[model samples]
Target: MKKYFYNNIKSKALLLTLASITLFSACEKNDDLKIAPPTTISDADIFKSPARIEGLVNGIYKALKGASLYGGRFLLYQDARGEDFINVTANNYTAYEAWNNSYSSGSNDINNLWGAAYTAINNANIVIEGLAANPGVVTAQKTSEYVAEAKLVRALAYYSLIISFGQPYNKDGGASKGVPLRLKAENGPENNNLARSSVAQVYAQIIKDLNEAEAALPQNYTSNELNTTRAHTSTAIALKTRVYLTTNQWSKVIEEAVKLVPQTQAPFSTTATAVKHALQTNIANIFASDYTSVESIFSIPMSTLDSYTGQSAIAYIYNTNSEFYVNPTGILGDAQWGSTDRRRSFLRLSSGKQFFRKYAKPSPFLDYIPVIRYAEVLLNYAEAAAKTGNLVLAQNLLRAVHQRSDASYVFPAAAISTETALIETIWKERRIEFIGEGFRGPDLLRNLQPLPAKGDSNLQTPAVPLTAENYIFPAPNTELSTNKLY
Candidate 1:
């Protein structure tokens, strides 16, 4: 989990350096003497060797683990924007602006997140282009796998950016403007003036990349660790389920989901060809020491040497320092979430305040940040089944996720008697299961639901309606300052 070469670049100037081919020279006075080794390697040299090429591929994953991206802040900001959590410290360095729904184009979180995501995207683009330019550097099969891996990472990064900066696709059928789509490698400032694409256009590219990646990616890696951390066939299919779910493509969701998740019964899992992903018998094991569990479809690996610093870790913000705590009157107050439910084990009370313990790691906070899980895929399939008039299959899918945590709890007859009630029950299960995992904001926006308000005596924020300007994050000032077309 060591930080790769790409993590050192922190600003836009350094970001543009990704495509630069640095050269070294020595003075004539030292012509007779041996020249010192060059400090930087050219991008061309990197793709000439298999090891260096693999390093470039790993760099894409490293970029996603930045604190402002998926590592912590992205998850923290998404949860803070929802109603399930109340700000404890109101610390600006944390997600205060996001919790209050008051962030503007100039906000630090907005700019940093936008920068980090695009940095990852650019790194992926460089890998794809560099590998293609240098053919026969590796076997054709290995080359295809490497390029497909990069495409998957690029697709994930674009999906994150479009959902954050642009309006939800379900709102206007993706007719509104989305983030700028950068496909080629940007070695200089010439491409900085590219205009934003439509939301539908972005999604179409995302699906296209995913489909290509799915066809080329390996069914499974050699080990459990690689299977959980790297892009594979199941990984791409699991993500498609989520993307299709967001766009309200029910049949597409079901079509993509069943590739990985079998539709049979309670113990749902993939076949031996793909990674064996199933719900952990105990809900807590996924967050504990066993990070390489089959349940994790894909996650950003973290370790003591390469982990979030200061308050950037999710554990520090929610568990250690207590910057935010669970909202009593929010989802936790729902009577349907029984007191005896095993999922309640994730909740902890300290000094009369309840906080989420899903990210329970201490100090360096070496918990792997989950990008997608099997439970989520199951729930996504369940929702899609319910929407497409397959209630029997939907109920079976819902029961698999629910009973895995609480074996004795039963869905009341009224709860599953109708299509509407069953769908509502599935939604509630998602909120409880993914409370601190960053699905809250996306869940609200995908359905065009308003962001509900929540606070204590210290602060009170209003609900942001669908028509409000703050419903979605604005394009960052950094992009506007450089991209003239924006």
Candidate 2:
């Protein structure tokens, strides 16, 4: 897979350069390139045809596959930064630096994330330019829709950077400093010395892209299961819900989620059959050999045999020595996971430390790491409704997700009666439901909630309040060196 990636870089950059446009290929070799003599494909010719446009759009998805967002590295960055997953395991020790401490300078994972996400943004910008220059490239409805999909992904990549490295859009940190914005297809001296835009501006771009994306995207591309690979209207809406909540745009959160829920999609919501949440009920099924689970809205494809490079966070959680596997016990016990539950089988050990088996692959193939899921949408609605004083609606949504996890369990009527309790319950369910996934850090940061100390195993224990200032991660040294923005 790495070789395939390398070859694509060589060809695409050459093709784009020959086509007379600034190239931003993520797979492109990280070396200096001199603009060569022009060839057959002109800037006019590149986007004038549908094939070229399709190729450019395909690059957007390909860039997204860069190690920063997926390809193993992003997974580690997310875990190391979150309250879950301690680096007791020696795997990827540098990653533990960023997770445990917000201010990391020379961390490779941090550096890689900044570079890769920027590369994706550049590719998106190139495509948007092409679409504008050559409107004829997408005459058909499907092609046009795909163009919108590209915009959504581009927005997503930028938002990832903003939330992690900077601050929420409406906060003081956001106003003070943010990451640089690259919205053109230029590869010259002029590209240097650009300053960081305020988080407000960055979010403005994100919103613009998503607003257009929501309009162009389909209701659901291929149902909840298969839709994990593709972007749809609901994913965009759900993402917006998160973005707005981060920026304290409560009205927007409520508005976006309302638009999303009524879509009434499967896996997105279960039937009364009590089988709705059964998909992830086994716990182990969430990380099964099958990547296309019913709950995953979108994920990075990891192959055990070929594509498995190993995620740093997963490696740290499960200590993997040559002869034996070590698991660090975090929240679950062996009995809690149960021998029958696949998650427990893979993630738990009788030895004091419990390691996660979900991401464990002896071969090169890794499990499909989820980026978005239907479960998040449910949680989003529950939180938004609870915040808006809609306790009944929020409780029902919370119960919908919780009931799916353990079908036999029931919530007392009084427990569901109040807004605060229901909100807290929904939050707890989110912590459990999305553990080991990347959402915890952002979820905590966005809600202005506190990070749990190592001692707070019982999630119900009260947490010290965290603020928006805690949301901004210090810019890595590499970025600071290249662009004095930090």
The local distance difference test score of each candidate is: 0.82, 0.59
Candidate 1 residue-wise lDDT, 239-325, digit = tens: 999999999999999988888876467678887446778888877888887777899998877764467867788888888888888
Q: Provide the lowest-lDDT 10-residue window in model 1.
A: 23-32
* TM per prediction: 0.92, 0.77
User: Which runs of model 2 end up more than 4 angstroms from their true locations?
Assistant: 1-49, 90-94, 140-143, 169-174, 219-226, 263-286, 303-306, 310-346, 412-416, 455-471, 484-486
Best by lDDT: 1
Model 2 Cα lDDT, one tens digit per residue, 223-263: 43435556666667767877787787767887876664653
Q: What is the lDDT of residue 23 in candidate 2?
A: 27
* TM-score (C-alpha, index-matched) for candidate 2: 0.77
Model 1 Cα displacement at 300 (Å)? 0.8
Model 2: lDDT of residue 273: 18
